[model samples]
Target: MNPYFCVMPFFGAELSSNSNKITPCCLLKNNSNIDEIRQKMLDHQQPVECSVCWNLEQKNIKSDRQYKNEAFDFYLNKDIKSIEEDCKKGLYSEQIIKIYTSNLCNSTCVTCDSYSSSAWSSLKGIKEKKSIISISALAQLDYSNIKMLSFVGGEPLYEKINFDILNYLIKAGNTNCFISIVTNGSVKLNPDQLNILKKFQNLNICLSIDGIGKRFEYIRYPLKWDLLLKNIELFKSLNINLSVSYTISNLNLLYYSETIDWFNKQNLPYNHNIVKYPLHFSINSLPKEFKSLLSIEAKHLLRKHLPQDDAQFVFFVKELGLQDNLKNISIKDYMPEMYDLIQKNI
Candidate 1:
């Protein structure tokens, strides 16, 4: 057996390296083949037991007093000190801190649950308000275990508050922590602002772009698509890891492939999210034709990208099944008010 195959045991999937059939470790009576074991390892790189099988095994073991005692002894004798140390180094190094610098935004996007016009209008009325975090407050934070600090808002670059906080973090020699910002990429960052971001090698930025050309304008509303592209190019030139976050909705459901192709050409990592039950409207707020298209695209993507043994993908598909029910129900059936809201806003 190849020495690399020895790593397989750590994954808890018992199968011969030659045959590639996997037997579920949770199964007390059955043996696994090598292929089944490989698939299980690919499902989750992390060590995890099959929840259903584990529960079943636990029940069976409890029925047998001798087996139950053996299981208890095995667990008690397991030396997990090395595993605990590795986890501490990788994940527990820091607590994540999120700073909401300001609620002000330049663009009024249609899908913005965070900052609708009504919400901003109310915030604007607060007298003597401090929109930005003070430099002193940021310096006071205990950075003992802060793995990352995220700056999020109506749009981090819409105002000077974000820059203030970012500058403080950089100057404080807190290079150990990763710094990230979620931006619309509309505001053209100055050279000084760009330099500040570049100082932190672990800094990352997420740009939200839903579609290409006019479709983006329609959904994002008031956001300049060209300016966003220009800013993304600027970030690329700086050698920053720029991620495009695309929120999949009925408006761009049919255009998923087109958008993915575009991102691929741009050499940018992209992620997609299905429209969830929003605070304002139900599935009825989405157009029927678009909703149906979204369902089809979502199913196709999941089946194509997800492996059979992936538990997370299985759960994801189950959730998509519920959303697919909108095919029989029109958006107007549940969200008539959304039409009026969109019309009034537009």
Candidate 2:
């Protein structure tokens, strides 16, 4: 058995308008490199395409590769030669599917871009359109045999296509398949939507929460903290598996200790990943002096995910100033401590 084997390259796929190539996962770049990735795994060699997982593993953090392999273990337990043959002969079907239907989100999060959120496009006056998935493209997939279906979006809860895909699975009598949705915990699910979701045997709702209270509202932008709390209670009432996905960036890393304590008090299942793109938002951009005051855990995280350049701090400050002006909001009002820290450093 290949100890480094991953099932995603051959048995999983991600559908999004962000790329034209067949992408096996959202963390991986959109490209037709699956064959290469698969062969590399077969040879017990790590492919650069799977660096996200390797990086996380190096930091002793659980990666998507580990989680996916475990989740799809039932399907991958067959003979290795048989699995290879099946894939080559087109007998193996896609059992894990991740779909990002459109960029039709309500809130414009600081870390997000116009490509992922319609609200960001509107705020920036970019005139971008929602990139909805085509019916023909969705029709190509065999949903009946699927073991897992994941949806993320402009906010999966707001995307009409997300529910449409759920309805498709329900109608196909594939309600037993695992369903995962990453939402912003902003939208309230309607009775009809709630009923549809209740029919699934395994449903995991992972909220994208970067910070808590006013800080959350500040980073997520225009999304009220009260609304998020109300929605969290609403999802809790559903008796489904709920979890939180926390992203640590320059905006929220300073508040990591408190936010994590809050998650612990709420007894919420949670996982965190550091922001690496838009290098300015990375924790590494923070001055050493500011970072010196961070919690031991936060400092450890910073070390794990080092910054490409500390100079990017200037860009983050500039961008925040521009956004504060446009939104008619002040970071000093929402995040006084962080504002004070930045002020002293710069």
Candidate 3:
């Protein structure tokens, strides 16, 4: 068994920003690197293209590589040895599909951009809505061997292509297949959409929550805190699997402890993903003095992730100030403590 073996390269497909391109995983920067990653894993060499997972693993955090390998191990009833052999011989079947339908989303999140959110695109004067994935291209794949289908979008719930795929799966009698959607918790599922969702027995709804109350509103602008809670209750009523996808960023670092406490009190299970794009939003962008005021636990966790260069931190301050001005919202109002610390230092 190769320690670097991951099931993603052999058994999973991810839609890239381009409609026709499919890569091994979303974290893989270059689609062309997929084959190289597979070859490296088979040779027991760590692929540099998989730095996201490697960084997490180095930080003593479980990476997507580990989680996917574990999940597929159970699904296929195969150990690492058999999986490694299958890959070595170029024998494998796709069992997982992750699609990013389009950038048609409702909220312009602080950590998000025009590529993933239509709201952000509109704000930036980008017209011509387009799909990152081709629905017809997916139809060509064999659905029989599929064990998991995950969708992320501008907002999957609001994307018509998501329903198009779901309808296709339903027609193929693949309702028993595990389905997961990462949503922003802003859109309510209409009766028809709710009915379609109810057909799936294994549905995992992962809500993207960054902060609680006004902080959440500030980060996910044009979204009401009350609406999010109401929608959460609505999903919970379905009795399906629910989890939180909490994103960690410089803007939300100070609120982490309290926000996590909120999740714990609600008995919501969560997984945190460190933001890397829009480098200013990265936790590493926080000034040294601001970080010194964080709790010991937060400080320790921050140590796991690499710190950004000073230039990026300077960029972050400038970007936040610009956005806050444009949005007519003040970070000082939503995140007073961190704002004060930053003001004192920078």
Task: Please provide, for model 1 over 36-123, each residue's C-alpha lDDT reduced to its tens digit, 9 standing for 90 to 100.
Answer: 4344533433222333233324443222122322322233343234323333343222234556555667654545533333233443
Candidate 2 per-residue lDDT over residues 76-138, each given as its tens digit: 466555565565565656789988778899998888889889999999899887888777778
Stretches of candidate 1 above 4 Å error?
A: 1-94, 113-140, 279-296, 300-346
- What is candidate 3's lDDT per residue for 1-346, written digit by digit as tens? 5779999988888774456677768777754567777888888899988888988888777788987887677766788788788878888877788888788888888887776788887777878465567657777767666888898888888887788788888888888788889998889778989999999988988889999998898889878899989988988898878888888888888888998899999888887788877778777777676777777656755754334545677888788888787677888887787678778866
Worst 10 residues of 3 by lDDT: 301-310
The best-first sequence of candidates by lDDT reads: 2, 3, 1
> Candidates 2 and 3: which is better by lDDT?
2
**Model with the higher TM-score, candidate 1 or 2:** 2
TM-score of each: 0.55, 0.92, 0.91
- What's model 3's lDDT at 72? 77
Off by over 4 Å in 2: 30-32, 74-91, 304-308
Of the pair 1 and 3, which is ahead by TM-score?
3
